[model samples]
Target chain A: MGRWEPNARERLELAALELFRERGYDGTTVAEIAERAGLTKRSFFRHFADKRELLFSGQEQLTRLIAEAIAAAPTSATPLEAITAALTALDSIFDDERRVLARERQAIIAANVELRERELLKGTVLTTAMAAALRERGDPEPVANLAAEFGGLALHLAFTRWIEPKAGEAYAKLAHQAVDELRATAAELG
Target chain B: MGRWEPNARERLELAALELFRERGYDGTTVAEIAERAGLTKRSFFRHFADKRELLFSGQEQLTRLIAEAIAAAPTSATPLEAITAALTALDSIFDDERRVLARERQAIIAANVELRERELLKGTVLTTAMAAALRERGDPEPVANLAAEFGGLALHLAFTRWIEPKAGEAYAKLAHQAVDELRATAAELG
Candidate 1:
């Protein structure tokens, strides 16, 4: 148990997701997840604070990716353009292999109220981060906040479509389409 | 305890807020709230599922009000126009007296992660309700959802301003200004 294990974090995540799907999220325990992963509970705790953290461990990385992308956008880019760059940056993470895990994770979250709330909080945090990055690039308050919110909405729609069983479009493409649709929708608002 | 209590709900809410403000949310008990309200714990339970409900009991009513307002908008109204009507309808709930309570409530929620998560969930629920009402009025999916999100952002901005100590404008006015500001920001998003 004291010895280091290879791929311990990834193993715990897959095992936890499998257990959560087979048994309800509420019915699974850390000990069971560790057992399924063939790791010590100590190793499991080393990777995640709890079962929920296993599901959201990528949030911090995703937030940083988005913020950095927005920051790296050309200085002349509009708020929405900066947000589009941020969305495009996420394409690597949502590659085909991850789509399967994403679908499972969405189902697990949809079935639990606590997880849904946490997801909303995480969405809010990311949106705020995007806005902060935009502001740092010299966008005003209203533009930064509104663009961040629009970006959040586009990401949500893109993710929803990306997880559909019959969906074939790339994440970046879906995200671009979502943003264009939002732009059209915004233009038509009376 | 078995007899009916006049304004029992309101009394309980006030008592709960006071206790929460004085002792902090986690330190206050339903029994203490009930006692402070000059009522029994049974009366408290009869009005609210728990102490958290005391803070969010208005969510259902607010959701219904916004949805109904959107439904009642003129047939020729655009999605954003209908959303505007819904925001104006909330003016009744944000009168000057309620502003004081809202300020305290916001502080309480800001200080606690659990409460903040619940608040975000409630906000999402209200936004969903607004979008559904817009859909029922024949706005397509994208328009309905985007308009509802805008309406939510406006409501958030309006509420934040309305709770400020120096805020002098009516809630409806603040709400209208927020929507207009969002529209301007959207137009310039490029």
Candidate 2:
């Protein structure tokens, strides 16, 4: 719990998201984010490569979470099952408090084409990593690739649905529902 | 036949690909591409919104093609079936010469992350268009989305294999192989 306390990186991320939402991604500056977080610009640079990285550093964490989950799924699990498990595992990281920040991040991304591209790239990177993890779990080539990509799509759908103003439903529930819909879609296609 | 015989737009696209490959995407300018194509800078702007648009102008045609194919597919066709039909129909547009150009474009994009993001965005836009078209054709929400997103994944896999240096293989054949693998993966998941 002590380790969970706000550090320089955490403060920078929160401050950057707030500033990006208020002033727009392009309209804001690294100095502003650092100053808002009560940190130095040098600390901000040490925490992130650039402004884009500020918005996208979570992608690194996402890849780590999904790849780790896929690697940990039972060897007997099918590729799709592994992907589902991996995605479901990610839902815990986005608690109710984080959901608000996630929604604002989505809104900021939606308003900026550059940010949207970064978002898509992040998804692509995660899918690619998940596929590799599945392969390490003994899944074959194209099968692992397809399953990981479909999982990415399922996550995208869940994120879209989860961000809407709703009751106290957890993102994990929404994500699981989206995965079920994906399975149904596959069944229909089959 | 005359209009098809290398208009300014065509010349610019060809010239731009060459220059991009030689000098890198960021190293080249509209003026350089226009001069190389023996056209004025105004002519380049008339055809594309920006330098990035020159590389992605084909996305407009792709959206139109896939959407029209979905609309024109048999009413009884399943969502996946319609997407397959649409993608296969796209193959005829890529002749041997265009395949070479496509390979060059892929190489250029692979070397540049900025261009890679745009490429992903183009795929996303196409998938979204395909989903909307499926909806217009009476498919359900997540089904259309999942099917369309899967179709995009299939397209990605096929393009990856198709662009490989093979012995005079057609892009359509590679695409079919990828789609078959996608179907198998989907069935396995089901």
Candidate 3:
């Protein structure tokens, strides 16, 4: 609190998102983002390494948050409950503005194959991170890993449904229902 | 039988596998594979669209085999049991020249992100196809789709474990054990 950064990063991100949505990721450049933010390219470089970096820069933070949430989950909670709590924590971070930002981010990533691959890799990283966090909580290793994998798969399924223009209600609510349906399906199969 | 065309596709597939094993996927070319098969480039194209197509050329046949297996399963059999039978059918196809081909195909795809995405998409396609097959056999749609997705996830997890360089004994056996473990884990959590 002693030093306020004046939301420079948020401003940069918003400006970049607007420009990217208007001009497309390839058509827009770091220079454009910087100019829109009333900053120099040097300042932009200090913030992000490149154009793609801006799109993915929040992933590390998100991963850290998920990890922390999982770690802080009650020991008596079942694996699924722990996971749901962690996801709920993530939902809070992704309020309306963040959801819009994420939708745009997904749009840009979806249109580009390389970006999609990077997004997949990012997902893999988050899964691995979540698994590691579960293991740290003394869960059995393979089960812990699989639990995280299921969480990831569930998230993807939920998000895919959420992004559809026809999807109604809140994303978290849809995600919770999807998880319940998935669990019911899995149990019936089992 | 008289107009068999001498199983030209199989010959070309064998030739491609040999060339890939000898020089790796990147080092091998369509022309080289054709030359090794003692066939013209046109004949190679007749058999496969490109070198990459070789990786998935048998997928259609394998899907049909899996569908047949699932269809033939007893109605009294549980969902997991039916899906296990389908996986067994898949194993028969992969186990013939499994050691080299499985590892080689995996390595080739893992090294390339686009190939991995295509592989995932192919897996999703197969899941949809299997789900449709299950529905045809009297299972409800949502349950059928979930069964297919669960089976696919288990298979992917099992294959990842089975393909480890140090993974010992028969892969089919390992896969069966992995499925059992997954069922147990799901039960425990449920």
Best by DockQ: 1
* Model 2, span A1-190: residue lDDT tens: 1353359888988998888878888989999999999888988887799988888888888899999999898888888788888888887687888888888888898998777777878888988898899888788877787788788888888777777877467878878887887886777863
* Per-prediction fnat: 0.74, 0.56, 0.32
* Runs off by more than 4 Å, candidate 1: A1-3, B1-3
Q: State residue A122's C-alpha deviation in candidate 1, in Å.
A: 2.2
Candidates by DockQ, descending order: 1, 2, 3
The residue pairs found clashing in candidate 3 are none
DockQ (C-alpha based) per candidate is: 0.73, 0.52, 0.25
Docking class for model 1 is: medium
**lDDT, ranked from best to worst:** 1, 2, 3
Which is superior by lDDT, 1 or 2? 1
Docking class of 3: acceptable
Write the residue-wise lDDT of candidate 3 on A23-98 in tens digits. Answer: 9988998989989987778778878888888888978887888798889988887777767766666676666556
Instruction: State how far residue A99 of model 2 sits from its true place (Å).
Output: 1.9
* Model 3 agreement with the true structure over B42-161: per-residue lDDT tens digits: 888887889888888867886898789899999987777888888777776656357666776788788776677668656766776778878888887656876776677667776777
Pairs that clash in candidate 1: none
